[model samples]
Target: MISNNIKIKTQDLNVYYGEKQALFNVNLDIHSKEVTALIGPSGCGKSTFIRCINRMNDVIDICKIDGSIKIDDKEIIDNNVDVVRLRESIGMVFQKPNPFPKSIYDNISYGPSIHGLADNKSDMDKIVENSLKKAALWEEVKDRLDEPGTGLSGGQQQRLCIARAISVNPEVILMDEPCSALDPIATAKIEELIDELKKSYTIVIVTHSMSQAVRVSQRTGFFHLGKIIEVDTTEKIFKNPGNQMTQDYITGRFG
Candidate 1:
């Protein structure tokens, strides 16, 4: 059943790269102001599914997508869509921390500046501070805004990237293996941040860690070989999955 709170919806969604198919009729509904986690083994098309949300797949020369993707009930697969503006409303954080080679201030302010989100220097400064604070890195990096973003430690750099994503005031945030490279403590911090961020933004995360998915998400979707085998509330999916494959994968029997 499709809920009235659905923030993003995909129906009969299919994706391809040249002659190879990456996704197969993926249908998922992400609720507003909630965290939805996608979990699967390697090469299961989990990342491909989220990439389709913001049309990031459009960059690949051979990529072709069909079917329907809607945000706020508006179709986005059409060529007439404003991609730049579409991207502005949907933020993405990648697997690894890939901050620009610029200073922390520039990193956060760049999106707002290009999008004309700030009117003056003071406004930009405020956006930078607020974004960093939201990402829980303001207290740590506030004193060093002029320093290069890449200079921060791994966890701090990841937080900075999160801040950069939120700086543009996106309504939806997509994270693909956001904590894959971080240590345990760093992963916990990111998890905490995700919890807080979901209060204001719709978050979709692709994760390989079952524990992480249970901890951070309200809804969980299990993908296998380019198809979604099951999706349910996180508690139900973890404690008692409806599919045998889901049960096996979560139990370490098979991936």
Candidate 2:
């Protein structure tokens, strides 16, 4: 069961890229220290919706957004919010593993160093070690900290990216189809990592795999054609969804 503690809240949220609108009236509450999954077909606004929470869409020249997404009771859509600092608080992991060309140790340390989260070299070392341990990659890459992050395998690279995202001690972690690029074994590892991560940080994942959603998320939201059809507990969303579209999608009638 999900706790009543809400870490993120969205109401009447909308997103547009030039003339094409991507989302419509998206209202959701993400519980603190819980995993919430966004499931939908390709281009159904799942990715767009998560981007709105952390203001990732602000980088695109054509993007425009309306409505409110609040974290810890503070509205993030307003101009007063410091986007760079807000991003440090809400870390993001992309669909593909995109680690910098730097060494593995530098990959994790860079964020903390830039954000001034570390006071010195020793603090940086501790942050890197802890982040890697949390991502379940410490033992595997501890000896190779000086090696290029890109030299890692697909799964390792993704995990390294996860370590980087958490190195700054973010409150929320947003994942967009994080396992789509990996093999089944790699996917399983990431899923297991996600399950463990929810104990410390609020996680919002956008995935196409319903089974993945069921495996990792406590809450599930079904999206379709630029709108959220329904949102509920993972079991309720999969086993007894209230909307016809949600039921059909879950039963594999159509994507």
Candidate 3:
């Protein structure tokens, strides 16, 4: 169930890559324990918007962001913020499943180990098991924990990545088109995982698939040309959007 509490808030958010602006005065509020989906055409800044939540854009030296991003009503855009700790609390799953070449167990244990969430081998073992179970991949790979994560099938590898994300016990999860590379069955499984995960973690997803947004999200924000055109309940956005551009886009008239 979605909480009334706001988990993340952004106001007047703008992004530029060497003077090429990517986002424009974006303002959004994400509710706690809910799936908030961002939908847009290509290059519309959907991915850029979610990346800002975890400060993933900092990797690009040319990128410059100026705005207010608050998590739990605390400013995160400040220079004084501990970025590593912020990222530990917000996990990200990218469009492609890029698991490390290490073993499946290592993949799940890596985050907890780095964060010092476990004291001993036994504690790490429990964290790995629980994370895999949460990701719905434990039964499939429990016997092959020593196998390389890259050895798994694409779907399994993606699940392994998800397990790694949750192993750190993040309060929020950001998925950038997580199902784009997946087959329908795999996509369904991931959607189900999102449904289950929303009970414990706030979720933000960027998707080009409108059906997917409707299926997995409680609230939807429509972005176009680096700006959010409309934001409302998923049902409202799909069935009765206030903006003609949004309606046209949803109806396949134009992107």
Off by over 4 Å in 2: none
Best lDDT goes to which candidate? Answer: 1
For 98-187, candidate 3 gives per-residue lDDT tens digits of 999899999999889889999999999999999999999999999999999999988888889999999999999999999999999999
RMSD of 2: 0.9
Model 3: lDDT of residue 184? 96
Residue 129 CA displacement from its true place in model 2, Å: 0.4
User: What is the overall TM-score of model 2 with all chains considered together?
Assistant: 0.98
> How high is each candidate's TM-score?
0.98, 0.98, 0.98
Error of 2 at 193 (Å): 0.8
Error of 3 at 223 (Å): 0.6
Which segments of model 1 are wrong by more than 4 Å?
1-4
**Clash count per candidate:** 0, 0, 0
Tens digit of per-residue lDDT, candidate 1, span 177-213: 9999999999999999999999999999999999999
Q: Please say which candidate is ahead in TM-score: 1 or 3.
A: 3
Q: Is candidate 1 or candidate 3 better by lDDT?
A: 1
- The alpha-carbon deviation from the true structure for residue 53 of candidate 2, after best TM-score superposition, in angstroms, is 1.0
Error of 3 at 156 (Å): 0.9
